[model samples]
Target chain A: MAGASFGYDPRRPVLRGIDMLVPRGRVVAIMGGSGCGKTTILRLVGGQLRPQEGSVRVDGQSVPDLGRDGLFALRRRIGMLFQFGALFTDMSVYENVAFPIREHTDLDESLIRDLVLMKLHAVGLRGAAQLYPNELSGGMARRVALARAIALDPTLVLYDEPFAGLDPISLGVVGQLIRQLNDALGITSVIVTHDVYESLKIVDYLYFVSAGRIVAHGTPDEVRRSTDPFVRQFVDGEPDGPVAFHYPARPYAEDFGIRAS
Target chain B: MTSVATGLRRVGAGTLRAIARVGFAARFFVAVVLQTPAALRRIQLTAREIYFAGVLSLVVIMVSGLFVGMVLGLQGYDVLVKYGAGDSLGIFVGLSLVRELGPVVAGLLFASRAGSAITAEIGLMKTTEQLSAMEMMAVDPLARIVAPRFWGGVIAMPLLAALFSAMGVFGAYLVGVRLIGVDDGTFWGNMQASIDFWPDITNGIVKSIVFGMAVSLIAVFEGYDAHPTAEGVSAATTRTVVGASLAILALDFVLTVFMFRGLGNT
Candidate 1:
């Protein structure tokens, strides 16, 4: 079958027309190595940037149909755990969690506090209420950003490299929280990351992007046996063979292999 | 593309873009005006900016004013004494301080200290993506960040300008009446009678407010738009300080011309 394609470019589709549906209450992982546009797909889906061709629809509204206010409201419905948590260093933990509620709603102080505490509790950070973002460990900061994300009870949550910088223990804790929260909150989840084995263990289904396209999609067992060269090489994380070195040569270099230095 | 077409488009877009950006700035000051009723609501941050703009600026304003007053006194005395109107030293120092020198000098001090700092702070925040985080979380950065500062500088400039005028008069009094051996009573009495409140003092207050808004607004705009890269941040910071300082000087000239024209007849 021809690879159906469209994405940031019209003439050359980023996704090659591949399609993957995210059900409302399941966790799906999109895995790809660095420079594979994994984060671009997430940004496209999350409305950070518009698809250059075709469309991205969140709950039937075209991404561009949303104005600033609409996009803000749409984003509030989707929690994002940005790389390294992206917590504002200026706000304390409680205030970070309370930020969305304060902006989007007119909840009274008591109600706002109650909601912030609940999200913090769910993330196992109820005790860190008064702490500033800088005071938290990597795992704790990610959890605080997670808590802030889920403060408004979003229907879908996007994790952009949630486990990128965590230690093994912290990674395990975060992986488990994603699973636990998925089950407990009944929220659809999309994780964009490169932590192959750990991500396979946590996710229900997998989509792999390569060269700005969704190269593979399946259950864990199906993807494990795939023969696609790029997919195989990526899953194996090999430094050589098949994938080949494609680094940018210097501007003055005459040919690809010539080492100008 | 034809050169003429490109040039025309550039000119057209540049004009519109500047107008829009200026409107963006005007909106910020308007927001500050709107929030004046709730001045007590955001008291802490406003007070912090005020203290930063005011108390920390005291030394610079005083020293600069003393020197400025002394220089203006000497220059005005020299020029007037050539006509044997040495008695007009009071008129020279008092009118210059109240009408022009006072506000511009205080604003220059502020443009250096507060203006550079505002630009750098906002530039750092921009490069770090903290400003984006604020927007995503629905923080009205203009209301929270820029507005307090614009108004704080506005209030601070006049207060500093008044202090400037006082010190300048004192400096002139020292240099003119004592050192130059002019009559003390005539100098003192002439200044009091010649200095009118409306066109001189009120005009200083008005220009300083405008100067304060321009300096703070340009600094924040340039800083908030600084790129994440270090080179961009440095460029933005430099641009902000230079741009704000130039803008203050230009506006002071324009306002002076229009102001004296309007008041000259009266």
Candidate 2:
């Protein structure tokens, strides 16, 4: 994406003058505070949203310029894991993994069944294939979503907060799987997350955004050793930094109705 | 004077918003219709919706139909007996059920049951991001989800209405002839002679179909347009029920006025 700017309301832009890139066969992570337009970037890439200015191109094709058929064709080559799994509750694990294949191909049920099982096996959840999403633990559900995301073996996979709301063990497991999957499938991965430590461990490159602008971009080692206050605050997990812990407010004394002492 | 001007402005703004909402709903309805062919190509999806929207509501519709019919029979008998026309009780119950109560009441029940269910399901799906997930997978949620439910209601509405009318006539028979001592022959003979297939039965079916379209369209549109939150889904479900009910009654009145306009001349 180059100079991408977008907002649900045009007058209040959520992303402004953004440029980011994901090279082939690499893992990149974009980190930011809540509501900083991280997920909006993912939507622009998937063509779920169009940037108001500048271009979002994937594999030499501009996303916003594509018609319905073209956009769908482009999306076929991209997979996304939402904040939660977002698995179809009505479908079983095996069926969830099989959905894209069934919708995109004319493979027989027998062939689809084998592909679904293989994907489930890759996620180490083959035994849980018949289980519904609601029946799985949060970690296990995210794993199933990982399997579903790679079912088509796309060139690119986007992860939106892949480690949110997880126990430590689950978080480690997910972080490892993301790295392992990127190498194994030779697929480029772009993750949007605020999990600083985990992303530092796996990602080849990092982009730190603040209030819709890229404040810092570096390799993980540079990010850790750098003196940039924003990067320091994020890496050190400080209570207050360039981004204040407190929202803008009136004077404390006035808020409490206390006269000056 | 300033306050009154503000009030007038508020009213004008509300009217414009309402009109804009209606326009958006009309466009959504058209999109659903455009996707109907794709929905029908995979008939099982629509069949599943019919089971949810129509088959599931059967017991309520039938029971309500029966109770309404029994009351009509008792009331019609009381009124006719005063004029020494007690034999006309079956005709009264049959006409009222077939022409008005069956479609209107069945529609009201369906709006509360099936229409609300559709909205809640779709709204919940939105809340959970399943619809967004589908879109990201390059699957159009409109074709895969909304169109099937829309067509299912359209196909099932008239059938349910017919069933309601049938059950109602049976209930009337039980009350008017079996209990009230009206001659069975006179009851049957009178109903058969007075009820016309085109004017009464067909017109009723037509009304039910229109009600079905209105209810289904409102339900799907509300669901598709719901805010992606629990409270939003709840509010959308409430709107579906209320909006569908109002649409059914208002459409029924307009249809009745047109369909039975020739009653005085006849």
Candidate 3:
């Protein structure tokens, strides 16, 4: 992505002159506070939304310029895991994993069944294939989603807050799976998350966004040693810093009617 | 004078908004129809929806039809007996049902049952981001989801309306022939002679098809346009029920005007 910027409303932009590049066969992380336009970047990359200005190119094809057919063709080569898995509730885990293949290909049912099981085994959930999405725990659902995402063996996978709302054990397992899958499949992975420690452990590079702009970015070692206050605050998990702890409001004392001392 | 002008402006703005919404819905309907071939290729999807929208509502429809027909039989008998023409009870009940009551009542029931369910299902899917997930997977939800349900309802509506009318005629039979002691042969003969296949029965079928399309379109459109939130989904479901019911009634009147213009001459 080069100088990519977008907003639902043009007047109040969510991302401003953003630029990002993910090298092939590497894991990159985009980290930021809540509502800091991290997910918007992922959407731009996925061609779900076109940037208002600038270019989003994946595999040398400009995404924003693609027509509907072109975009769908491009999307087939990419996989995305939304924040909460977004599994089709009415379908079983096996069916969810098989959906894309069924829609895009005409492979025999036997082959499709084998492929779905293989993907599920990779996610360590082959046994849970018959269960409905609502029957699984949150972490399991996310794993199912991950299995579904990589079922097609795409060259690029984008994960949006894959660690949100997971138990620590599940988070660590998910983080490990992400790294292992990236290395094993030789696919580039871009993760949008705020889980600093997990991201540092897995990612080859990091970009920290704040209020629609890249505030700080570096490798894990450099990010740890850097003196940038924004980076330090985020790293240390401070209560207040460049990103304020309190929302903007009128003076507390005045609002309570006891201002004068 | 200022207040009156402000009122006029408000009315004009409301009218324009209504027109814009109608235009959008028209475009959406076209898009849905364009995607229908793809939807039909996977016939199982539409078949499953037919089960949901049509087969599942059978109990309520049959029960309600029975009651409506029995009431008509009892009332028609009382009026006919006063005039000493009670033998025309079958024709009275059959014509009322096949011509008007069958499609209209069944459609109203379906709007509440199946139409609301479709809206709620789609709205919830949106709220949970399932539709977005489908899009990201290079699948058009309109083809995979909406079109199947639309065709399902269209196919199901006529069948359900037919079943309702059949059940209603039977109910009237039970009342007028067995209980009230009307002549069975006369009842059957009068009904067969009075209700023609082309104008009365076919017109009713056509009315039910139109109601089905109107209800299904409203349901799907409201679902697709709903805001992706819990409250928003609930509101969309409400809109589907209310909008479909109103559309069914209004379209029924308009269709009746055109289709039955020469009421007695036909």
Candidate 4:
């Protein structure tokens, strides 16, 4: 993505003049506080939303320029694990993993079954295939979603808050799996998250966003060692920083008539 | 003068919102229409939805049809007996069921039962991000999800209407012939003579089809456009019933005028 800007409502842009790159066979993390346009970047990468300015290019092709059919065609090469897993509740775990394969391929049931089981096995949930999404625990659902994301053997995988609601063990498992999967499958992975420590341990590089733009980006050690106040504030989880703790608003005292306006 | 300006502004804003809603609905209809051919390939999904939207609605429709027919029979018997034309009860009941009550009542019941369910289901799916997930997977949610349900509702409406009409005729028979002592031959004979195959029966089916399209489109569109929250899903489901019920009634009048009045002369 180059100089990409976007917003849900055109009058209030969320992401502004952001630029980033993800090299193949590497796990890159986009880290930010909530509502910092981390997920918006993933949306643009997946062609789910168009950038208001500049472009999101995947494989040297601009995303927003693609027509409907062209966009779907491009999307087939990409996989995304949404926040909360977003499993089809009506379908079983096995069916959830098999959905994209069935929709995009003419593979027979036997092959599809084998492929689904293999993907589930890779995520250590092969036995949970018969269960519904509602039956699975949060971590299990996220793992199943991870299995599904890699089912198509996509060239690029985007993870949105994969570690959000996971326990420490599950988080560690997911963080390791993300690193392992990218390396083993030779696929580029971009994870949007706020779990700074876990992400720093596994990611090849990190981009820390504040107010929709990247404030600092480097290898984990370099990011940690940087003296930039914004980066330092975020890295150390400080209460006060260049990014204010409070929203811009009217004065507290004047509203109570204790002081002149 | 300020009050007048405020009222005018409110009216203008309301009109613009209404226009925007109509435009959004039109676009949704077109998207569903275009995706229908692809949805056909996934017939099992559509069949399952038909069972939910159609087969599950059978009991309510059947019972309502029966009760409505019985009331019509009782009312018609009272009037016809006064006029010494008691045997014409079947003609009255049959004409009402085939020409108006069958399609309209079935449609209202369907909007309450099936249309509301469709909206809630889709709205919940949106809340859970399943639709967005499908889009990310390179599967058009309109083709996979909305179109199947749309076609399912369309296919189910006519069949349910037919069933309601048949049940209604039976209910009418039980009251008019067995209960009221109307001559059996006169009852059957008058109905056969009075109800035209082309104008009454076919036009009723046509009305059901149009109602089906309107209700299903409104249901799915509201669901698709709903805010992704619990309150949003609840509100969308409410709008589905209210909007579809109003659309069914309004469309019924327009269709009755066009199909019965204009076509009756020809």
Candidate 5:
């Protein structure tokens, strides 16, 4: 394990029982196929949902036991980029980003405006402040969501599927932006995505999750060389490996032009 | 974990949810009762919503109320003639309109009209992820979004109910004096003396408040649970109206029974 170990359990284990301590100010990416519960891991860290059997802690405050305000305070230090950017469609982009700063602080309007502008500028969308969320492209929406996420100068940023449904150009821009923001802001980031090739090129560390378990954890090259069958399937994007789409391995030899034994 | 600890946790969570639901309702009334015009930015948005709610639906409400009043006058006069109390026709129509028909019909109408409106608006917000975004930014939707509608309903219901009651009386007066050939002075005099008691008026006002609370609660509840899909929003809207309508009838029945038995309104 290369990052902080998440709590493991029998009754309700998170998608992975990863035991790797994520160093502060480093960018870590958890790469996995869809439905592997990558988002659950991030949510557990974000203090939204509690693991039924184990403890999740943020800054040493146990998530399962946190009061509402305590959980909110803990969340203030972390920013999350939800799928499709999750911008408030009812509000303009300016209001969306300003929302976090306003709720978490009593910063006066003038100071809040300056901070919101600074955040939007970081995402390179400051000019789009007056625009509604519906006007933005997918990549731009994700960027705006990123801006809102980092509004409070969060210490940790959790990005869920940043490169999902993105064009290669947009993908590269998002990847570069994620890395640049992490470095420039000196913030730790956990990117959850299935974009193995793109994420591998940028992430400092990688964890592969499959079947509610961590199959491999290490640097990009290390994980790329792992002998596990699921790891091989994920990294190589192979259709016929240990990761079978169909349930039950009983008819195991039906695919790959092989007969069942 | 021990079973007792687990049980305690379950109880605690249930209690918290109940508290939140109740708190949600109280916050709605508080916002309405204490609304200031200077909450302008938010109020501007909410006022547009209220216009569509309270004003735009006026035509249908008035039309519907018109028919109800006409029918009440016809029926009351016929029933009074049978009792050999035809001269007291105004009293029966007035009392029934004031204490019985006014609040209940308006409530049912509001549940169909504005109750569904709130549900649909909130449900759309839910489907668009607007509500979730608010939460992520630490905005309490209950306080900012829901409370005003609840209180506005409380304020509006009484006005609408009073209008409905008054319209019915006018219809009764027309039927008694012109159609049924009763004297105009006798009709008005009987109505003034028989109905319009202070107690009856108080009961009508209280019933309007209760109806407002019911409609707002059902609408907000549906909107809050609306899933992030078109189908979900449609279902939420339908449920809000139907559920609120049934709840209104039940509440009307309870209020009618309580007022007649204890308050001596019947």
Candidate 6:
């Protein structure tokens, strides 16, 4: 994406003049504080939302220009793992994994069965295929969702907050799976996350967003060594820096009538 | 003076918002209609929705229809006896059920039950990002999710109305003839003469179909437009019930006007 701008409300843009690139067959992370438009970028990339300005291009094709059919065709090549997995609660794990394949292809039930089981096995959830989404643990559900995302063998995979709420072990496992999947499938991966440590561990490059622009970006080592205050504050988990510790507001004394208005 | 101005402004704004909301809903309805042909390709999904929205509503409709018919029968018998027209009790019961009561009452019941359920289910799906997930998977949620439910409701409404009318007639028979000692032959003979298959039955079917489309459209549109939050889903579910019920009643009145305007002339 280049010079992409978007906002749910026109008066207040969430993402502004943004530019980013995901190299082929590499894992890249877009990280920022909460509400910094991280997820908006993912939506733009997935063709779920059109950028108000500039362009979001996936594989040399402009996304916003695509009609409904073109968009869906483009989406078939892009896999997105939403935050919280977003598994179909009504469907069994196996059916959820098989949904895209069934919707997009004419493969018979037997081949679909084999393909679904293979995807489940990769996520180590082959035995959980019969269970509904509500029956699975959070970690198990996320893994099932991961399996479903790759069901069509998409060339691009997007992960939105994949480690927001997970036990340490589960987090580590997910981090490992993300890295392994990208390499094993030869797919380009873009992960939007705030888990700096885990993300730095897995990602080949990082883009740190602040107030809707990429304030800093580089290799993990380069990012860690950067002297930029905002980057340093985020990387070191500091309490104060170029980013304020508190929201902009009126004076506390004036609000309490301690001073004349 | 300022307060008066503010009140007028608020009312004007509210009117405009209502119009916009209706426009939005109409567009959504058209989109779902356009997508229905594609949705039919997934016949099993539409069948499942019919089972959920139509088959599951059978018990309530059946019970309510029976009770409503019994009350109508008893009341009609009492009134007709005062006028020495007790033999025409079947005319009263059949006309009421076939023309107005069956379609309107069944529609109200359906709006409360199946329409609300569809809205809540879809709203929850939105809250959980399942709809978005489908979109990301190259599937149109409108085609995959909303269209099937819309068509299912439309197809089921007329059938459910017919069932309700049938049950209601049976209940009326039990009260008017077997219990009240009204002449059984007179009851059957009067009903047969009074209820025309086209004017009475067809109009009711048409009313139910229209009500079904209105209610289902409102339900799905509310769900699709719901904010992806717990409170938002709850609010959308409530709106679906209120909006669908009102739409059904309003549409019934308009349809009644049109249907009865040139009754004997037709």
Per the 3 Å backbone cut-off, how many clashing residue pairs does candidate 2 have?
Answer: 0
lDDT by residue (A128-176, candidate 3, tens digit) is 9999999999999999999999988999999999999999999999999
Interface RMSD of 2: 0.6
lDDT of 2 by residue, B119-185 (tens): 9999988888889888988899999999999999998899999999999999989999999999999
Candidate 1 Cα deviation (angstroms), residue B253: 1.9
Per-model DockQ against the true two-chain complex? 0.25, 0.80, 0.77, 0.85, 0.27, 0.92
Error of 3 at A71 (Å): 0.6
Residues B1-266 of candidate 5 have per-residue lDDT tens digits of 69999999999999999799678756654654454342333665556546666776566666666677778778877887898888888887787777878888888888888988888888877775556555555555665666556656666678788878887787777777888788898888987876655678888888888987888778877777677688988898898888888988899889878876885545
Writing each residue's lDDT as its tens digit, candidate 1 over A1-261 gives: 123334565665555554667777989998887767777676666666665456677767776567877887777778878777777676799998998887779999999999999999998999999999889999999899889878878888888899998999989999999999998999989999999888888888998877666767888787788887766777788776455566655554555566757
Best by DockQ: 6
Per-residue lDDT of model 5, residues A148-178, tens digit only:
9899888988898999999998899889999
Worst 10 residues of 3 chain B by lDDT: B257-266
lDDT of 3 by residue, B198-265 (tens): 89999999999999999999999999888899899999999999999999999999999999986764
Question: Candidate 1's residue-wise lDDT over B1-266, tens digit each?
Answer: 69999999999999998899778767755766675644546776778778888889999999888888889889889999999989989988999898888888788788888887777777776665556555545455666666677667767778888899889999998899889988999898888788777777888888888888887777767776677678887887788778887888999989988887876643
Interface RMSD for model 1 amounts to 2.7
Model 4 chain A lowest lDDT segment of ten? A252-261
Compare candidates 3 and 4 on DockQ and give the better one. Answer: 4
What is the overall TM-score of model 4 with all chains considered together? 0.96
lDDT of 4 by residue, B72-108 (tens): 8889899989998898898889988987899989999
RMSD of 1: 5.0
Scored against the native two-chain complex, candidate 6 gets a DockQ of 0.92
User: Per-residue lDDT for B65 in model 2?
Assistant: 88
Query: Which has the greatest lDDT?
Result: 3
True contacts preserved, each candidate?
A: 0.09, 0.64, 0.70, 0.82, 0.21, 0.94
Residue-level error in angstroms, candidate 3, position A132: 0.9
Q: What range of 10 consecutive residues in model 5 chain A has the weakest lDDT sum?
A: A1-10
List chain A TM-scores, every candidate, in order. Answer: 0.87, 0.97, 0.97, 0.97, 0.87, 0.97
For model 1, what is the C-alpha lDDT against the true structure? 0.79
List model 4 lDDT by residue over A1-261, tens digit each: 999999999999999999999887889999888889999999999998999998999999999999989999988989899899999999999999999999999999999999999999999999999999999989899999999999999999999999998899999999898899998999999999999899999999999898989999999999989999988888899988888888887888766768664
